[model samples]
Target chain A: MIQDRLRTRMGWLHAWSGFVFGLLLVCIFASGTIAVFDTELTRWLQPEVPPSATALTDEALEETLPTIRKLLERDEKPFITLPSERDPILRVQYHDGHEFLNIPFDPGTGQELAARATVGGTFFYDLHYSLRNGDTGIIFVTFSGLMLLIVLGSGIIIHLKELIPDLLVLRPFSARLRAWLDVHVLASVPFLPFAFMMAYTGTFLHTRSILPPVSYLASINAAITPVAVRAESPALQKEKTVVPALPPLSPLLHDAEKVVRAGQVGFILFLPKNILISRTDASGPARTREHVDFSYDGHFIRHVLLTTPLTRTQQVMEGIHYVRWGGAGMRWLYFISGLATTIMIGSGLVLFLMKRRRLSGGRVIFRLAEGLTVSVLVGFPLACSGFFWGNRLLSGGSEQRTQEEVTVFFLIWAASAVWGMGGCLMKWRVQVWRSELGLLAVLSALLGPLDLLTRSGGTVFHTPTVFAAVDLIALCVAAVAFQIARRLA
Target chain B: MIVLCSVLWIVSLSVQAVSEPRMLRIARREAVAPALTVRLMRWVSLVGLLLCLYQRPSTALFVWLGSFSIATVVVALGWAWRYRGVQRVRRTGGGS
Candidate 1:
């Protein structure tokens, strides 16, 4: 009787909590899943740049620094991130608001590429962890992650008796609700380890912002800032002096890679007097979370490793969460696992409403929940497709072209929300779901064609298979949306 | 390699089915006595999967175990569907 009572209480918590926060979790999971390919998506977003052959050599690095130096403002923090497998172009970038205003350069030469200024894959990355609302978003996501952990625990308790059976048995032709539940179990069982890993690691990544003890009390206020904000370092700032010219980065890069045992020098952060080059990309799974430091004039400094057990554990957690060391195959595995998690959340949303709809079909609160469901499930994808279309169609010469692209995305998404809610109010729930999904299908189908038509000089010269692959993925999205729409109809 | 992994997965599930009568409606009485050996073979297949991937053991274990679970689920469902279909055909006395 006690066990039964515990299971019943857990089932209630699992269902009610999921219903309350399912939409937000779905968006977070979906965006995060997509972010596994953020590098590729960023490449796809800007199709005009020619493919880069290799990273900058010593002479090329020396030539590029002058232009990069000219672009730096007195207060601005300038960074040079070397190219990785997914993103071939070297970037001289800095944090703006939600996006990076980066100057892309030919890695082989010092020549700059005229890539259009737009938010690329970084948009999904921002949306995933923080929802681009800065600290509040991070806190909210962290809290939701906690909620997910609770839900996972409760769900497992409720299903513990049948966990193994659930893993092995999937009854597709069973009663409708049973079928959905079986699927939920199937998707959840094999991927439970991944889900728990992501939840804990994701929360840990933003622990400084969320936990009061690790950070100063004022950090709570600082979290409200719209940009990339961090707690001020306790170390005193160096005296203001004339900035010195940088030495050739090639030698530093070679030495840093050797010291850190990382394949590629992912990025170099230039401090007032020191340079910190982080090992962002590594060749294989044994990648270390080590960084190498150097004096301003290129003299080698000591290697910095996460030696403390706590910090090292955190580093390992982050490594598994981000998969920075993994090659393409590993990235694809992350992507697929992420997609499965997304689907799992999505089906849970469906089950939540399906159960509620049967009992209180026309109740005001139920209708509102149904409307929100339609908006989130379909509206976000519609907004993403609009962003891609706007990137291609919006004129490049406008002063606020980047902002305009973002504005277009939000406007379309807001419009879809309003339409979904209005349709629900007017008793057009089915119609709303069908139409929004259909529109998404059409928009997704057009992204590839739009890219093909708008290819400029560099895109025409060097054939980028990445662009083709991206377009193919968009077509696949369209096909999936169409299939869903047909099923709903 | 993907094919080899799939075959190993099938063997793992088949071993489970042979060892445990509850897993399937049709199991030979003699099959139940090989339970210990069959269980041991399942572990061997799992270890083989980890070796075949040739990656960090943690990552390979995560990737291949998840893959094996999915493949097992697929084969189990297929068996269920076939058994149901055969039952239906016998009941109707024809393939109509």
Candidate 2:
């Protein structure tokens, strides 16, 4: 009787909490999944930048100094990141007051490619962790992550007896409610380890941001300034006075890689009197604080690697979450797991409404919940595909072109929310899902053709694999969406 | 090695499914004790993990866990396909 009471209460908590936050969690997980290939997505977003496989040449590394020096002169914190497997082009990026502006360089020649500016892959990264709202978003997402643990715990407790017994059973052919519950279980139970790992690692990462120690007192200046300006770092300013000609980075990279591991030097941060060459995330599964420092003019300084137990544990956690060392296969694994996880949460949302549709189907609040469901499930995906569309169609000359691409994403999502809610207002829930899904299918199908039409011949010549792979994935998504849309009809 | 690990995981899960009485009944096969089969299945998976660890010690743990989830999903989908086929066979008055 006690266990029964516990299960009953836990069921209510699981159902309500899962539905409430699932609306946001689904989007977060979807975006996080996409972010697994953020580098590839960023490449596809800008068609002008050509991909290369060649290693960085010494001359090319030296050529970037002129640009770096110019940025340094203008009081900017410019840094150089080496080419990685997924992103073949070298990058010179700096904070441009609003965000980091990345300039792609040919690894062989250090010639800057005229890539179009957009948020690119980090858009999804930002969406995944922070919901694009900065610090406030981080705090909110952290709380939601804690709630996710609660929901998962309650759900497991409620279904403890059935978890292992029904582990391999997924009856898609069963009755409607049963099928959805089967899907929810199949998606959740098998991937419970991943769900827990992601939740804990992700939340732990942002724990530092939410902690009170950093801001023992609130910043009054934050309220006074309507527009936040980039503050010049005092260290960088002091370094600017010295302005000594630095040695070629290729040799330093060679030496750094010896300690950091070959082909693992991720980025080079320049200071007035020192240069810090940090190990790239792809170096290993542990994101260690390992770097090799040098004095002005290429004199070798000491190498740094943290070995404390607590720090090692943290580094491993960071590594697990980031998966910077992941290859194509691992990336796809992460992607599928993330999508499956999202589906678990999404199906729970569906089950919540399905369980209640008979009693509250016509209520205003119920209709609103149904609409929000469509917005999150159907609309968010449409907006994702729409982001690619906007990247291609929007003219490149406008200053607000980047913002316009972002606007396109938001506008489509908002419109989807409106369409879903408005249709549900008229009791057209089925019609709304079917129509919007069909639209998503059509748009996603068009992405490939649009890529063929819009992308430069140079980009195609440079990276045929990237162009084809991206288009093929879009086509696959379209095929799935079309089938689901057909089923709903 | 990771590929080998993934294949082993799927095979283990498939073994787990076939050893289940419900699955055997659906397939029209007689049930047997799964104790030995379960032990062998687990050993296969463990050796696969050992091979992965031997190959890439740092990534093996996460990769092992990652492959486990993915492989379980694959087995579940396979079971669904098998179950659906059996159901269709029954509806059409065919033998399981």
Candidate 3:
């Protein structure tokens, strides 16, 4: 009797929790899945930037830093980022007034290249983490993660008996409820560990925001201010009295290489007397903070470890969330887990409508559920595809690219919502589902070729690993749309 | 035997909640006692769990002991409440 009661409680918890967060969870899952290959996506988005044929050498880095330093000193505080295998251009970021400037420098000569309107890869990085909405996005995503934990826990309780029996079950003929239940259980059970890890890490990522104010108070008292120090301003130094003789960069590059033992030196920045060299370790986890610093004129300084033990712990937590450290096998595992999460959210939403249909026994509730399902499942994907379309269609160097992308996203999402509502009036389930999926498939498939034509083949065929992966994903989505269309037809 | 029966009841209740519509119907039928008591019990349990998590117990031994003790008490209370409600409902319905 007690066991039965406990199970009942778990069922209630899971069903309601999953229903409430279903839409947000779907958004998180879809966005996060795409974000897994954020770097590749950026490369695909911007194919005009040619990949460097020659590796950036220490001598080249040394020669380039002095000029970069002089330019950076003239403007705002300049922090130079050395290029890696992933990105070929040396990037110098500085602030002029409220506006930020990201100037790419030729790695071989240290000469300033054309200033880009967008910091291409970093834009994707920012978008994935915070959606460029800052703290609001973090709070929203973290809350979604917490709700996911509740859903996972409750789902297990509700399906304990069928868990083992229905491990591989995917019944296509069953009623909507049964189908949804099968999908939810099937997707959730196989990737329970990965889901749990993501939830825990996601919660940890937003610990400061979710926890009581006392934690922040304790942080301040513990001598840990969250504010980071600004890099020395290039503009201030530029205005300062000229010192004709500047330090040579070769010695500094050599010293940094010795300290970091990186296979290649990507970029070097000299700020008056300080020389910063960035090294790349492709095999290990991505660490933007680990680099070698030196005094201008090649005097060995200390290796600047940007991340502390505490921060490293956070990085590892985020690494699990981002899945960057893992090899091809782990990447595939994460990909499957992410797909499962998407299915779980989608199924949970369907389950909500099924339960409502059973309760209401009226056409009104069914219509509402149908509209909601259309808006959430189909609408969100359409919005994302619009963003990619905008990237392709908008001319390069156009100041309105960001604005246009945002506009396309909002317009598509709004149209989906409106169409969903209208479909309810006509009771046209087949029409709604077919049209939405059809449009999505068309848009997604068009993206690859459009990218090829517009952006000089947009990395679709650049490297086999990336090209095959992206093309395969796009094809699978297209297949799903076709299947849905056939069913509707 | 009582504990085993209680466990079985909870398990059955959970499965019924998912698979059968009758359990929710029954829950709705019980106007006050079962519905209200279950909700109150849940809130109390949730609060206790939150407190335990927030404190961050220093030792593994301490955590194990505290968790076991809390679980025992919460389960006992929940089971007792449920048994009482069932008995009252049965008496009122005259063994329907």
Candidate 4:
């Protein structure tokens, strides 16, 4: 009897919280999954970056010097990222207060790439954690993740007895409610370990919001630094700024390569009198914060490879969550897993509403809740595909084209919400919204052809690329959405 | 080797899946999988996973874990196809 009571109580918490947060969690999981290939998406969004990276010659590195100095003169700190497998272009990047705006340069020709500026895949990455709202968004996502863990736990307790037996049992032709329940269980139970790992690591990455660092603490009895020393540092910084000419980078990069593992120096951070070249995150599980430093005049200063156990643990956590250490194969695994988890959350939301429909179907509250479901589930993906449409359709010469693309995304999403709410007010059928919006996304039907036609069509056949996979995936999605819309109708 | 380990994971899970009576029906057998076949496959795949971990700890560990995800979906789809002919699994009630 006590066990039954506990299960009932947990079920109550599970239904309400799962429905509430699962709506948003679906968006987060989908965006995070796509963010797994953000760099590739960024490349797809920018077609003019050239098909291959030329050798990282000193001449190519030197060409970026003038541009870097110009950025420095504007008091913006700039860095140069070396060509790597994922992205084969030398880039001059600087933080433009909102996002890292970059100028791509062909590694071989030292000429600037005419790639159009779009938020790119980083849009999804930012949306995943912060909903693109910055710190407050991060806090919201972090807690939503925590609530997801709770929902998972409660769900386990509710189904503990049948969990193992039903772990792999998915009966798609079962009763309507049962079929949805089976999908929820199938998506969740079998992938519980992954769900748990991602939720924990994802939240851990942003724990500072919950427990702010020492900077949050009052400065009671804090030691004050000498004002003169503080003033001296900026004076020294100004001196370095004045002496902007840099030493030849090719030789320095060569020496730095020997210090880093596999001789893969991914990025070069320029200093007034020094340069810090760091190891690539793609090389290993522990992004060990390893680097080699050199003086501006080509003298080796130090090579630092952090090996402390605590740091290693942190690095592994980041590597696991980020999935940057492994090759393309591991990334696909994360992407598939993330998709399944999103399906699980989306299925659970459907189940929650279905289970309650018999009891509260007539209430305004239920109607609004249904609208929210449509907004997130059908709306977000609609907006995602629309962003691609905007990328191709929006004129290339438009000013602030990045923001324009993002605005297109939100507009489509808002339109979905408007239709959903309108349906709520007019008592229009759910199937109408589902099939209409679902078909209208065309499930991103033209994405592949759009990619082929707009981007230089040569690259598609010549290279195995992220854009190709995205195109193929969108086609699959189109087929699936057609079937779903057909069935609903 | 990690690829082999991933394939082995699917094979092992398939072996266990056949242990269920519902799954056995797909193989034209009324009997469940032999206890030994299921146990042996499980042990073999697990030990291979451990050895992979020992050799290339980071990649091995990640691949080993990731295998479960893909394997689950693959096995589930297999189940779906086998059960495709059946409709209304439960006539009047929800799933257990």
- Name the top lDDT candidate: 2
Estimate the overall C-alpha local distance difference test score of candidate 2: 0.82
Which has the greatest DockQ?
A: 2
Model 4 steric clash pairs: none
Measured against the true structure, the TM-scores of the candidates, in listed sequence, are: 0.86, 0.89, 0.68, 0.89
B1, model 3: CA deviation in Å? 52
Model 1 TM-score, all chains together: 0.86
Q: Per-residue lDDT of A190-264 in model 1, one digit per residue for the tens? A: 678878888888987887766767456577666664333332334534344566777888888888878765455
Per-candidate Cα lDDT values, in order, are 0.74, 0.82, 0.60, 0.78
Candidate 4 docking DockQ? 0.51
Q: Which tens-of-lDDT digit does each residue in A379-398 have in candidate 2?
A: 99999999999999898888
- Model 2 chain B lDDT-worst window of ten: B87-96
- Ranked by TM-score from best down, the candidates are 2, 4, 1, 3
Assign candidate 1 its CAPRI class: acceptable
lDDT value for model 1:
0.74
| Candidate 4, residue A305: lDDT | 77
